[model samples]
Target: MNPAVTPHQQIRATHDAETVRVYQAFSDEIADAALARGTFVSPPFKMERMTWIKPSFLWMMYRAGWGLKDEGQRRILAIDITREGFDWALTNSCPSHPGEAMGKEDWAKVKDASPVRIQWDPERDLFLQPMGYRTIQIGLGKDAVRRYVSQWIRRISEVTPLAHEIHNLVRQGRLLEAKEKLPVERPLS
Candidate 1:
C-alpha cells in the first residue's frame, strides 16, 4: 500500500518485472481453447466483442461467484500478459462513462476513437464484501483485443480450484487462512 495512493481508486495487481496478471471468467469452451493455444482464438473466443479484465482476485471471485456463477462464467483464468501491453491499454483508454472532467459529447467522441475503456468498481475483501477502495476493470475493444491476443499474453492458467479452496476457507470463517491464499498484489507503479 503506497501512502500516496488514495483510498478511492487504485490499480493493484499481481505482477513481476515484465508481466501483470489479470483475471477473466470464461466458459469451458473458451477456457479450453485459450489454454490449448496459450492465447484466445476466434471460434470460441469472439474477437469483435469487448472483453473486460480485472486485476483484483477477490473482486473477480465476487463477480464470478467463486467460479460457480454460471456455465458462461464457470472457469476462472489467470492470464499473465506483458506489462507493455497492459500499459498500452491504459494509455489509450477512456472512462467507461462520462465524468466531471469531460462532457458527454466529448466523452462519446473520445470513447469512439479509443480501443480501451476503464471502469472503477468496488474492491472486495476475503469474504467477498465490497471494500472502501475501488479496483480497475479494463475493457478491451477490437484493436486492443488484437494486440492483447497477438502480442500481450505470456501465460494462461486455470485457477478454479484455488478459487473454490479459498471460498471454502472463507465460508468456514478461516479468515487468516483464506487471506494467506490470496495472490500478493501491490500497487502498480
Candidate 2:
C-alpha cells in the first residue's frame, strides 16, 4: 500500500505554460564526464535502459544518501523540459503497484506495454525520516527511455551544490531555512 501523502511532503511540478523541471542522480563518472563534455557522453547510457527522475529534493536525498553514499549517485542534475512531454509520460504511466490508477487488466498491460511507471514513496525529511506526504519516482523504459534522452531533455544543470547546501543545513538543524531554499514544485495535471 502507498504511504499517506500530504501537502507538506509534496514537491509539485513547477510547470506553468511551457516547461517542467525534473531531477536525476548520476555517478560522478557519468555526471562529471557529461559536465565536462557539455552533454551525456560517457557510458553511452544505453538509451534502451530504464532511467528514473525525481522532482522532490528530500526524496532524492533519501534515495541518494544525500550524495554521501550510493554508487553512481554522487551527482544530481536539474533538467528543464517541455511540460507537454512530461504530461505525455504521466498520462502513459502505470502505477508500480495495483492501486486506484490500475486494476487487474490495467496492471497486466502495464507489465509489458507501458514505457513508464510511477511509484509514490513516503516523503523524506532533511534527516531522511518518512514525512507525512509522498514523492514521485518515475521509471522510464522502452521507447520512453529513447525519447527522454533524444527529445525530452531541454536543459541540464548540476545541482550538487544545492544538494550539499541543504544537507549541511539539515545537519546543522537549520531545517526552516533549508526548506525555504528548496525548489518550488506543483502537482502534475
Candidate 3:
C-alpha cells in the first residue's frame, strides 16, 4: 500500500500501469445507453457540455448520495481509461479558478482555450465528511471529450450496488468494514 499523502491536493485513484479509474454518475437513460454501447452516446449524454470526472470514490458517494441522490445521478459508473489519455488531459488543462500568479483576463483566455479544466475540491472520508486535503476533479470538454469517448475509454462498469453496500455498512456504524469495501486508491505516480 502507498503511504498516505499530506499534500493539500493530489490525484488518488484506483489505477494500474496502463489505466486509471474515474467515476461518473448518470441517469438510467444515459447509463443504460453508455453501458449498452460501451461508451457514451449523444442523445442522452451530451458531448457539448463539460463532463466532470472524479477519482475519489467517497467524494463521488457524497456527490451522488450513494446512488440515491436523484434520477439524474442515480447510477454510479466506474470508468477505466488509458493513462495516456488521462495524462493528456492533465497536461492540457487549465485551472478552474484563477490563480494569484495569473491575472483574471489571462486566466480566462487560457481557460477558454484549454480542452480540460482541473479543480481540487475537498476530499471525503468513509462517512462523507470533508477532509483536510483535496481531490482532483477533471472537467473534459470539446476535443478532450471526443478523445475520451473514442480513444480513452477501456471499460465501464456499474458500481451502484457497491456504493449502496458501503453506504449501508457506514449507516450501521461498521466503519472498518465500510472502509475496507472502498476501492484501493493511491496517489497516481
Candidate 4:
C-alpha cells in the first residue's frame, strides 16, 4: 500500500499463525480444484518431493508475480495446517544460514542437522518494495514433505482475487486502500 511512506520497521506486517498458515504457488492445473476442495494429490501436483511454504503474503506474490508470471505459478493458495504439524517442522528446522556468531564447530553440526530450512527475507510493502523487517520462507524436504501433504494441512483456500486486488491497488498508487483490505498478519505460534 506504499504504507503512506511510513517507516519500514513500523510496518513490518506478518501473519499470526496460531494454527500454522502457509502460502504456496501452483499451476492452475494443480491448484484450481485443490484450492476449491482444500486438498492435494498426485498428477496435477507432484507428491513425491519436498515443498516449501512462504508465510508472507506479499513475498509469495512477489515470487509468483501475483500469479501472472511463471509456467507453474499461475495460482496461489493459502493453507491452514495443524499447529502440531507445524511445530514438528519447526523442531526439525535448521537455519538455512547459520548465525554469524556460531563457532565453526557448531556450524558444522547445524549444517547437517535437519531437512527443513528456515530463511528470512526482507519484508515487502504493498508496492513490493523492501521493508525493514524480515519474513519467513520455510523449506520442507524428504520425509517432511510427505508428512506435510499427508498430515499437516487442515484446509486450503484460493486467495487469487484478493491477491490481484492488492496488486492492482499497488500498481494504481492506492496504497492506503490496499493496506486496509490486506489480511491481518503478525507472528504468533
The residue-by-residue lDDT of candidate 4 on 1-189, one tens digit each, is 344553333322333444666788998888976766667867677766668888778888888888888868878898887778777887898877768898777976975778788877877767677776667778887778878878887889888889989888888999889988777775453
Give Cα distance to truth, residue 84, candidate 4, Å: 1.2
Model 1 clash pairs are: none
**For each candidate, what is the lDDT?**
0.94, 0.76, 0.93, 0.76
Task: Work out the TM-score per prediction.
Answer: 0.96, 0.84, 0.96, 0.82
Displacement of residue 4 (Cα, Å) in model 3 is: 8.2
* Candidate 3 local lDDT, 1-189, one digit each (tens): 212646887799999999999999999999999999999989889998899999989999999999998999999999999999999999999999999999999999999999999999889888888888899999998889999999999999999999999999999999999989899998898
Expressed as tens digits, the lDDT of each residue in 1-189 for candidate 1 is: 333455688899999989999999999999999999999989999999999999999999999999998999999999999999999999999999999999999999999999999999989888788777899999999999999999999999999999999999999999899989999998899
Worst 10 residues of 1 by lDDT: 1-10
Ranking by lDDT: 1, 3, 4, 2
Over 76-169, each residue of candidate 2 has an lDDT whose tens digit, in order, gives 8887777777877887887777877678887887767788888888777668998666778888877887677667777788988998998899
Model 2 / residue 113 / CA error / Å? 1.3
- Best-matching candidate per lDDT: 1
Question: Clash pairs of candidate 2?
Answer: 6-133, 12-185, 12-186, 13-186, 27-72
RMSD (CA, Å), candidate 3 to true, equals: 1.6
- Global CA lDDT computed for model 4: 0.76
Candidates in order: C-alpha RMSD to true structure: 1.7, 3.6, 1.6, 3.8
Kindly provide the TM-score of model 1 when superposed on the true structure, using C-alpha atoms: 0.96
- Cα deviation at 113, candidate 3, in Å, is 1.5
Model 3, 92: alpha-carbon shift in Å? Answer: 0.5
